[model samples]
Target: MTSRYTLFLCALILAAFNLRPGITSISPVLQGITRDLGMSSTSASLLTSIPLLCIGFCSLFAGRLAHRYQSEKIITLFIGCIGIATFLRFFTNSPWYLLLTSLLIGAGIGIVSPLISGFIKRYFPTSVAPMIGVYSTSMVVGASISIGMTTPLQHWFHDSWKIGLGFWCVLALIAIPLWYTVIRHPYTAKQETVQTQPASLPLQNKQAWLLTSFVGIVILLFYCFTAWLPAIVEEKGYAASYAGMIGTISMIAQLPATLLLPVLLRVIPGRRFWITFFTLSEIAGLAVLCFTDITPIVASVCLGIGGGGLVSLTLLLPIDKTNSAMEASTWSAMTQAIGYMIGAIGPIVIGLLYDYTGSFVPTLYLLIAVGFVVIVLGWKLTQPESSQLEEQTVYQT
Candidate 1:
């Protein structure tokens, strides 16, 4: 690769690294936030879900935004938004204040998500799978680092969670300058002209919705683990710090699957076999949590591998089916909108179910059922040798 291409590649990975720390960092420090703000578990859960909801809402407009302006510029602007939101967390004295920050962070992340997919398609068309592997792995790495370190940071700051929560702002701040460098040089002037008005979103296509639902279900499974794994372990009599480590371990376990899924996709492009295997792993993890007396760590490993592989697959689906960067963005935006909206339900539902039943057992059962549904939904998701873009002729815009 040329030097410019190398820079853009590094920029992509760094930008992705910023994506999850804002959300996952909260999990390790959730108890401290609830205690400090005098909020209930249900209320605290919103810190994670509200961003997801905003991601879903903001995702609808990502294509329009990217088409209207320089995508790199828009991305840099939003990365700044995320940094500002994370910085504001240091001053959060009320639940509402913290929630407002979550809204900003989510909006920023939502817009960035689809645009990055387009960028991967635009700049690295031949290498989308491997680049996506890098992308998804960066996200998981971000989650692992944030979940693993936030509690320790809290302890280092004399048990102040605000410092821990606000620390991630540095990541966004760091990403801004590097991404801005990409904006200084355009890929091609013709590329900009072509994107002036790309095709409308694929809302009416059966395949699109199926892809959306699969994205939603896998995301729901992921955020559930991201939001609750720490607390679930803590409830089993472990110290808060140890529970946070469990969550970290789960995220760490995902790295292998994230890095491997792209290679596997090249060898086995069809989704059926991978889906069945990953979802079975998920079912086993949830079953352990629901019925067995095994350590939650074991369950975390299984869930991590399962959730990791499935989510990586979902990220690739829209790209695989669409033909161009703009088309990928449109499909990605639609899928992310519905997908994240559905994902938003995971944390809140688990929190409410736990609050209602005074136990996480029922929630684990619900997640297992959701896992089975994913397997069923994924049964038809075989990647074809040709683009399915022409098949999505139902609705536009």
Candidate 2:
């Protein structure tokens, strides 16, 4: 625990705090944005999903970029860009400009997310798990704060969602200087490069496809809820602030499950069985949402447990199944890139389905079907990785 590493820890936590609030804070106040911009449900859903696409697309390239440049410098630059993009939201009058800024925000976050994992492993190899827990919890804090505060800010600032949404820029502004000062130091500059081994593009491996799609399905389900849950609750006669409050509760519920799920999977065997149980949790949570109007809080908590657990567990599988650090990194990059792109389809699909049918019933049923697909994929996950094959992605360095 040297002072240098301690500083790395601070910068990382701060950076994690910025990653999601800029992206997620808009969810609670989406109704405001829609009305302010005169947007349809489908277009609004696109706004949310497009950033996810950028995150997925950029994540694949982030690894290649990190190999060519100093990761700390890359991280510092992206963190600053997130502040700029979030601040840009304050002046957005048209939907296209808003989407453009969302793309910028997503790229900054996408690069930071994968690179932070590598950074943690490099600087705190022996303490990776604990540091991950600390930073993951930091993300949860950021998301919940955004969900809880956005509505209040809207009301406080003369009923303007623009100010409320853009308020998250302050977090990025704070994180940028902290990360910059730490990374500019000499200690981080002299680290040896990590030797990498090539693994096939995820498309080449059938099992990898299963893993990618399964995680993507989980992600799809996760975003569908996040993107529209507040609006749905509002349709049910709750205030936007109340919807935000419930969203906050859902986010708070996510932290403990996200922290603990991977630990449970590691200590206990039967990866298939645990995976099935987690997938069932998603189906069950969606069922609750679809069937019950009497208990939104109950449904939100259930959804949180399912979403957090599935995301954490899926992330763990890439590492557990890979043979080496390079293989693990490859699997993770491909899985996130491909799977997230697939997952990004969820929000827009839900929006379009709702717009077409004028009901959410079809959307919920579709999500439940995706959950069953995850169950099937989880069963196949019991099979071992394809290690003997030489197929792999081309690396730049």
Candidate 3:
């Protein structure tokens, strides 16, 4: 790669790094937030869900916004919004305030997510899979660091959860400048905006809906695990520190898969095989958590590997299925918009199930069922015949 291309790649990865910390940081310090704000489990879950909701809703418009404006500018602006929202958490004294910050943070992440896919399609079309691996790996890095550090940061700040939650703003601040350089290069900006015709979202495509549903189920599993794993481990008799470590371990474990899975897909003969393999890994992890009191280390490793692989594939599909930056952006928007809305339910339902039954077993059972559904959808969607037929249908429309 050229030096300029290398710089843009660095910027893209840095920006991706900012996306997950806002959400992941909350889980480790959730108990403190509940104790401080006097909120119950279901209400506290809104902290995670509300942003997911915003992500779903805001994502619907990300493509249109990028089509009308510079993608880099839109990305930089939202990253700044994320920074501002995260910084405000330092002053959070009420549930409403915390929820509002979550909304802004989610909105920022929602808009940035698909545009990054578009960037890959536009700039590195030949390397979409590996670039997505790098992108997704950066997100895992951010999540691992934030989840791993939040509780310790809280302790260091004399038990101030606000500091733990708010400290991640530094990531956004770090990303903005690096991303701004992409816009400052006039040639890159010019190339990004050139399109023979604006790409319309595939609202009428059946395969798009299949992709959306597949994205939804997996994300639902992911967010639920991220939001509740710490508490679930704690309920299983681990100390708070150990519980946080479990979550961090899972996030950290994703790193290798995120970097390697896409490369493996290029070398492997069948996509469905990998999908089934990873989906089964997730189910096994959940089953272990549900049925046995065994140490969670094995489960964490299984989940991290499975989640990392699955998410890398999902992120790749939009680019693989589309022809242009704008098309990829719109396709990504459609999948993530509806997908994240569905995902937003995972955390809330888990919280409600726990509150009502005083147990997490029902929630675990629900995720296992969802995992099976994902396997079927993933198998259908990645089939070569299905992909060819869907591409013809989408282009003809």
Q: Could you give me the TM-score of model 3 versus the true structure?
A: 0.95
TM agreement with the true structure for every prediction: 0.94, 0.89, 0.95
Best candidate (score: lDDT): 3
In model 3, what lDDT does residue 118 have? 86
For 314-389, candidate 2 gives per-residue lDDT tens digits of 6556655555433555677777787779888999998898889988778888888988888887776665454221
Error of 2 at 137 (Å): 2.1
Candidate 3 lDDT trough over 10 residues, lowest sum:
388-397
lDDT of 1 by residue, 30-148 (tens): 98788878998899899999999999999899899888887899889998999999999888889999999999999999999999999988888667878888899999988788888
What are the RMSD figures for all models against the true structure?
4.0, 4.7, 3.3
What is the lDDT for 380 in model 3? 91
Which 10-residue window of candidate 2 scores lowest in summed lDDT?
388-397
Query: How far out, in Å, is residue 294 in model 1?
Result: 1.6
lDDT of 1: 0.85
lDDT of 3: 0.87
Candidate 1: stretches off by over 4 Å: 189-198, 383-397
**Model 3 agreement with the true structure over 130-230: per-residue lDDT tens digits:** 78888999999999999999898999999999999999999988888888878997334335547655677799998899999999998999889889998
Residue pairs with clashing backbones, model 1: none
